[model samples]
Target: MIQQYGSGEPVRLFTAGLHGDEWETTSRLLEQLSPPRTGTLLLMPKVSDNEYLSTLDRDYYTTYAPHLLRAIKTYRPTIYLELHSYSKESYAALTGDGRFERYGVPAYIDIEAGILMGSVSPRIRKDFFTPNDLCVSFEMPKGPNEQSLSVICSLLDVVKECWSRQGFVAYMSRHYPQQTAVAVKNYLRFYGHLY
Candidate 1:
């Protein structure tokens, strides 16, 4: 299902659960959905909600692509972040830094068009749609943990910068800053530090 929130120029689309059992993105999006978001946010938590456990192939998910495609055409979003999970090796290859510490720290956000290889939703088939839009396919470990917060936080950092460039920002005035600060404080406290 498609759910929308916020209002402004340069609509943003956030999609998750394209691959079966990959639920981190969906969870995070649902967690942060209630407060009035900044800019246009379109969320499709589960593209193939029915086949979530029975398949991982792109074709299976593509069967339901027309629905999202129609939304894209209608919303004309200028940004997209398709979230998914992948293997640790997949993460290493993307970074090429040989770091296997599955903390979901640094996410891959510079996925170029057409070259479908590593993690995340791989390539969302938005054919000829939002060509100039800022697109990213983010990935996490198959067995996600609390580290997923780091990934989400990092994504927020990037999105803030990118959105600012396009005159689009999320939750700037709605205690979003305080929420982020609290998250940081909580993280520090969890790690046994005071901030």
Candidate 2:
């Protein structure tokens, strides 16, 4: 587990490697682990094991949901950052972090096109996916690509500016129509805060 510095406040749960193959997120989040910032932070470098990692399709919890769920139940974080690398692009790409409404944060902003949203669903429980908290599936940063770091940072900056008010499921349901509120609510009930 990785933490920042601080306590008694909203916490951010930064994670990577729901799919074992996406290794960059693991490296980045690992570097971020320090103490707790504000309330508490639980960082899991690789929630899924190598066995599942080698597979083509993977589920966040079913594959490695137990470990990740345990952590979430133990610590109810304010923000969940699901980081991963895009597989479609070998070098360059950019995807809009679309959302259901323009309230503030984009539902699924893309940090890097080359990254994929390997399986982050199982990590979130029903309660956390409420109106207050938000989840961002960040595309891993590209060292050099069609999209510059500055551009990605700007998008992230915008999300950061609005994250306090937006909800993750609302934003996602827009672009991914299948991501209904009902499904989100149901998923949370089954997989959320696994203490």
Candidate 3:
């Protein structure tokens, strides 16, 4: 289901629970969110009922939950934040010594917050939303824990602050230069344009 709060431009959409098993923590996080000070916040706490939609495959969402896809298209959010979780065992694969390093997963460790932040790759974003829209995905270690919840909350605050002042892409490009460059290059290489 979707719950909307606040109003105006730069509509931000937050979706969790695309995979049934990983829904709990993200759903709880979305449930506790307060109304934004400016612009609209569209929260979809549960996006799918299929446990098998376990991967970040856009096709699964399009096929299984067409209504959710329809909702996203209709809303046309300026920022789409998709929340998900990974098992503790899988966390190693995503970090320093793992797939992130070898495969360039477009993820970074937020030194100040002590959490890993993952942004949608340009290739994936091309399939899901316009280049101008910022699409991010945060994958917490599975289960409910204080640190994970706090990190997400802090990230939310950062997202809001950046959106209000300098815009998400600008702020991200300033701080996360490498990831931003990779995203831009990938977008340009594959799509032949940034906008």
* TM-scores for candidates 1 onward, in order: 0.56, 0.53, 0.75
Best by TM-score: 3
Q: Give a tens-digit lDDT track for model 1, residues 75-137.
A: 877776666666666654555433224432222322322111122232342343433455545
List the candidate numbers ranked by TM-score, top first: 3, 1, 2
Q: In model 3, state the lDDT of residue 22.
A: 73
Q: What's the C-alpha lDDT at position 96 in model 1?
A: 44
lDDT of 2: 0.47
For model 3, what is the C-alpha lDDT against the true structure? Answer: 0.66
Ranking by lDDT: 3, 1, 2
Runs in model 1 deviating more than 4 A are 33-37, 50-62, 89-126, 157-195
Question: Per-model C-alpha lDDT, please?
Answer: 0.50, 0.47, 0.66
Q: Best candidate per lDDT, number? A: 3
Worst 10 residues of 1 by lDDT: 110-119
- The sequence of per-residue lDDT tens digits that candidate 3 reaches over residues 13-110 is 88878777777666877887888877888889888757555344546656766766777778877688877777767665654535445664543443
